[model samples]
Target: MNRSKPKAPAPDEPLPVEIVDAHTHLDACGAKDAADVTAMLDRAAAVGVGRVVTVANDLTAARWAAEAATWDERVFAAVAVHPTRTAVFSEQDRAVVAELAGRDRVVAVGETGLDFYWDYSPPAAQEEAFRWHIDLAKRVGKPLMIHDRDAHEDIWRVLEAEGPPETVVFHCFSGDLEFARRCVDRGYVLSLAGTVTFRNARALREAAVHIPTYQLLVETDAPFLTPHPFRGRPGEPYCAAYTLRDLAQLRGADVAELGAAVAANAQRVFRLPAVTARELRGREG
Candidate 1:
């Protein structure tokens, strides 16, 4: 495996409409403070990505993500202990995450769900945390952002048993057509990342076609899953523009229409403030 840092892909042409990176990590994308946040959002805004929901997978990152959201109007935060990190998740940690999740700009309680792919945390511990986060999302009245990986059935089982909050987002959705139908049927928003752009992602592309516009979302999942032709390259929020275009093409929808739909979906799913297309194109930020 190449241990070298992946270089960023060259910027793609700006999309004709607007988009929001429904899931990303500003910290991992090189944002450290307000200035860095401004600069990063600018880079994203330059290419039609007007907003992003920076997610946290741990206590410290949850704090950073919450604070980062306050730094920029275009940035939002999603706070939760990722399922993989649930082994050591404690009461104090839960307190802080709960406080952060209730903040005005902390739009979701998430990046939390089952991840059986890694044994960093036992299944029992993960389920316990997942249930707590689900309850927190309901209490805080925020959307639930899920990080389902190799645990789709279990994720669904937990969600059904817990009686999911009003809204749920399957971040970086990695399910097949059948699963996609199930999620959409239950009114869950599926946030697709750049994984759909891979050459071997034919199944994903086919699944994308069946999803309704209202239930669709797009993201970069940046610093990872950089779209094809730049597969190994580092991605930033701006890359959501590339992913949006490709998704639109794959779904056989007009780029502008799909962009508008997904942008609307993001705004609603995350309960984000309005981001007018004019402001984004004019670079008003």
Candidate 2:
């Protein structure tokens, strides 16, 4: 959908420490093959964005995400029928996603949850799919990454009712300080994205300050919410550096210290390898 030309933004000075992109969409970002995946990661690694978890929006994308993870050690995958696509989710679709969720490189089950902004799927359908994905994440013993867009209350309702997965992540967290406090109290991780850099997102910025260092994560949601200044342009994983810098400044924490904390949070939530094996594989290639 993002047909903008795939050009890397001017690179930021690399961070003193590396961090992982807790969520992204490589396929949607124009990464079509192993070469594309490598090239994307190369750009990201240059700015200390060392690892990524590319997530799926539908059954077809789920399969692609699984395969892409195998193409590079730095890349991991999350599979699910996005809330918007719940209108078409069938028994066969669930079977496919379940299989993908159990794959070794598939670290999370998500980009699920509710989205009231989009009417492509009815509320009942979205709720049904969200519950199913929660169960799948529990079964697979993986974190559940949520995509909440103007549907926070219902999202919270279902998550609370069905009971959340052990490791719950509010991807691109769009809640206010009060709501953030509840999520933190419930032990859910809040993943900040480019939107937090927007001048108008004052509430989100304030909420970021309240989140404990270990409960925070960063992401690009690439090809979507590019950070400020480059707001209208296409975003790549490498752009995460800008957001990391902004977040560090907002929290009044050193960039390196914040980066290290987020990296640890991502590694813990996704159960990523201690080191990025793909960087070595990339050099070998």
Candidate 3:
């Protein structure tokens, strides 16, 4: 049976707003070409997701994401091969990531980190790749976007061994409260995604409270992990709004404050420019 296509956004004049999505993947989102990206951005902007860090797990996707970032002011790119894609890394891979790090439109060095959930790569290979990506982040003076999954101990060990990153953001954080405290102590940023809205995400919710407000971030990880209300559906960057709203309620802060905090956290972590639609369009020009 054919699945229904994702509903495209209605054409509406873009509005001015201040928002940011800490994580996204443009190449894998099924939006091909400039017009597709324009529509996706329109949909995100309509819901106040004004800025997004489009992450790519390989050189091809990284290049595409960087080009996409150039297409719109709000879109910034994160370049790194994911844990599962460790085999793709080579000496030239490091050089390319270093080069991408220098681009103005490129933000962080990630969606990198440990993911033992599916050990497609040998554990040693994953560790090596994670270290390499972390080194890239250090070399470029950018934050490291981590993707830890069921390998918390190993992740901590590697980070400690490699020396702590200046800016460490746990994208799609899934650690327990103790781990949250450890991350907080290290001044690492904990980014919550759609999964936090799940009824069974007790550990995530508990960890959320323990993290300092300024240290918290929200993401979509979209094209995956759609939150509770939309769970079982394909996720998208625009759905980050729902996650943000749920987080604010959990934290007992106003949604406006939540937005401001997460947006600030994103800017701090990604070093993204203060992107308004007008500013973004100017960049596109």
Best by lDDT: 2
lDDT (10s digit) by residue, model 1, range 95-194:
9999999999999999899999999999999999999999999999999999999999999999999999999999989999999999999999999999
Model 2 misplaced regions, further than 4 Å: 1-8, 277-285
lDDT of each: 0.89, 0.92, 0.81
lDDT of 3 by residue, 1-285 (tens): 998865532322322335687898866777777888878887887777888889988788887887888886668889888898885578988787778877888888888887888858778888899998888888888889999999999999999999966999999999989999999899999988889989899988888877898898888888888887777677667888888878878878788877877788788778766556546666668
1 versus 3: better TM-score goes to? 1
**Local error of candidate 1 at 206, Å?**
1.4
- Scored against the true structure, residue 86 in model 3 reaches a CA lDDT of 86
Provide the TM-score for each candidate, comma-separated: 0.95, 0.95, 0.91
TM-score (C-alpha) between model 1 and the true structure: 0.95
RMSD of each: 2.0, 2.5, 3.0
- Candidate 2, clashing residue pairs? none
In candidate 3 the C-alpha lDDT for residue 60 amounts to: 83
Q: Which is superior by lDDT, 1 or 2?
A: 2
